[model samples]
Target: MAEQIIAALEKIVGANQVLRGDRAKPYLTEWRRAFQPVALAVVRPGNTGEVAALVQSCADFDCAVVAQSGNTGLVGGSAASDARRHVIVNLERMDRVREIDADNATMTVEAGCTLADAQQAAADAGLYFPLTLASRDRCRIGGNLATNAGGLNVVRYGNTRDLVLGLEVVLADGRVWHNLSGLRKDNSGFDLNDLFVGSEGALGVVTAAVFKLYDPVVQQVTALFALDAPEQAVALQRRLIAASGHNLTGCELMSRQAVSLACTHIEGCHEPFEVDHDWYLLVDLASSAQGHWLHEVMAQVVEHARRDGLLSDVVIAHDDERAAALWHLRESLPPAQVAEGASIKHDISLPISKLPMFLARALPAVREALPGVRPCPFGHVGDGNLHFNLSKPAGADDETFLAQSETAHTVVHDIVAEMGGSIAAEHGIGRLKVEALSRYKQPVERDMMRAIKAALDPDNRLNPGVIVD
Candidate 1:
């Protein structure tokens, strides 16, 4: 049966594009090595037609199909679940920049195109893509849309979903939906694009998309502000937003432990302040008007916050090099955590105003549940998303610490739920958070999602064990 399925997939994408046995190892394994899944074959589809045909072939063979692009997702959304019964549909070879319309301020790119490449394409045309992730160089556009990824620029530009104008998707039944229009205003029925953007491939495979672009930022300011606690960071953020509005492109919050870990593990990362504070806020403001006004506004806001005792220290980047260095520290947090040791991480979000309360309650509860756990919390505080991760105690057994993941998750997630927050934030509810989604999500909401999933993929052939089930 596996051979029959692989042969069919090979016929669709050509024999050279179909990988199996040892060759399929990389596609079968998840990036974090959390789940070592198995698959009959890894099929690289070269175009939308090939993807649709492959999906149909997998369904006819009664084999599950998992849509994967870049395979950089932390969640097991792109990994196969069943041995020999799943065929991985990888889109790496489908990479292409279809079109760029400067008059419309939009660009159309294939699903497999790396985000870094897309950003460069926009830059070459004297525009900005505005979806900036740490993994931009490797993570593809399809996965970004599937996960509805949020990054540094989300405060100003919004999530991957918001940046999209239209999408060309291959539905579960080998039917292609060609809605790739760059029109800003489309009163068409139902807004079907939203259904697939964050579906994690349960509904369809996002083949290509039209994305909104913006003018290049000519003047920018990056700064790191020292604060005593999360509340101070929130207060300062509110002040900055009030003063600068949409010009505030990025605002990140980092705990002392998080910063310390980054500085220790990452070579270029260093503590910018003379005296270490309990917390830090990394923020940047940008404008295309080309003047010192952006900097002046940011400086005035920071100085005023300092006078109000909301900040203890401030280090503003005066050059592009320093700005990149500061961003490097922010982007290096995840890798630094990996370098530190095993961790149980949470990508959760809450209302910006409720952030302090959530942190205050979650930290103590997590500590009580898992004693000696190192709480290293930080993330895009401007957008209310926090990577509240708990590192294992020094000299502790990795397995033993990981064994307590359930307890730690319950302790932290309960608080998040109580505060009207989402258990899964930027990252989609892949296999890891499926159970949590069932537990935290309202019964009606869950039922609706399941109904939609059933309607789209009745056999659950596309990315099984993803968003819905």
Candidate 2:
């Protein structure tokens, strides 16, 4: 059966594209190395037609197919994990810029285009694609669409799902479902494009996407501030949101431990001005009004925050170079934490109003449960999404604390659930948090999700064992 399928896939995409044995090793592992996946082969298809044909060949042999892009996912969904019974369908070869409808404020690009490439394409057309991530240079548009990725700009533009106008997908049976509509108000039917957006490749493979672009920012103002407490950051954020409105492009918070870790582990990242504080916020404000609009609003926010005793110290970027430096510090936290040691990570979202209360309760509970566990919680707090990751304390056994991950996760997730929050915020439940999803999600909602999965990929040939059983 393996020989037959390989031969058929080689015919669809060239023989050189059909990888086997050692050639398939690269495609079988995710960025974080949570687990190594075993696959029979990796097939690289150059276009939608080839992808459909490859999917068809897999179906013909009754083999499960796992779709891959820039395998940079934190969760294990980027590769198969059950056993060596899957065929990997990688989309890097299909990278292309099909069209840029700038007049219509939309760009149609193939799925394999890197997030950075997509953003650059929009910029080259004098527009802006607002999906920004640290891995933008590596993560692909396909994975971004499949996971409904959220990043720094979600408070302004929205998630990958919101920015997308339409999708070109290859279904389980290799039939192409092309709905590349760029209409702003298309209430014609069931909003079918949503099904595959955050499906995490459970239903189908996203081949290409029509993404909505917006007016480019003529000027941007970035600021870094030391906060007296985490709640102060929240209070200042509320005032800024009311005062600045949509001009507030991004808001992020880093706990003191998170900052120290970033400064200690990451090169060129350090405490600004040698000042010490309990928490810090990195704010990005931009305006299309061309002149002084960003400066006026951001200055007002900083002035007001200080008056309210919310800010301890503040530094506003006077030029583009300084702005880039501030952003680099904010983006360096994740890798810094990774460099420190093994940690249990949580990607969670909460009601903006309840963030302080959730943090107040969750922090102490987890610390008590596992005393000396270093909590490194940070992320886009502007939109209420926090990457609440925890690093093991110095001199602690990595394996021992990692073993207590379930306990640590439960403590945090329980509070999140009670506060009307989601356990998996920006990161999708890609085989990493499936049980947590099932536990926290209502049964009826789970049933509906399962029903959708059953209807679309009845054979479970595409991205099996992800998002759903």
Worst 10 residues of 2 by lDDT: 77-86
Candidate 2, residue 71: Cα displacement in angstroms equals: 0.4
User: How well does candidate 1 match the true structure, expressed as C-alpha RMSD?
Assistant: 0.9
Q: What are the per-residue Cα lDDT tens digits for candidate 2 across 1-469?
A: 5677778888999899988878888887677677778888888999999999888888888888888999888888876864445888899987887899978999999989999998998899999999999999989998898888999888778888899889899999999999887777889889888889888889999999999998899888888889877788777777766776667778899888888887898888867757688788888887677687768888888887778788889999999988888888888998998898889999999977778888889889989988999888888888889999999989788788799999998999999999999998877898888888889999999999999999999998988889897
What tens digits encode model 1's per-residue C-alpha lDDT throughout 1-469? 7778878888888999999888888787787778888877888999999999998888898888888999999888897878778888899898898999999999999999999999999999999999989999999998999999998888888999999999999988889999888878988688898888899989998999999999999999999999988899888877887887668889999999899999999989998888999999999988888678878888789778877889888999999999999999999999999999899999999999999999889888888889899999999999899999999998888899999999999998999998899998898888889999999999999999999999999988888888786
lDDT of the candidates, in the order given: 0.90, 0.86
Task: Point out where model 2 deviates above 4 Å.
Answer: 82-84
The count of residue-pair clashes in candidate 2 stands at 0
Residue 240's lDDT in candidate 2: 68
Error of 2 at 157 (Å): 0.8
User: TM-scores, in order shown?
Assistant: 0.99, 0.98
Task: Give the number of the best model, judged by lDDT.
Answer: 1
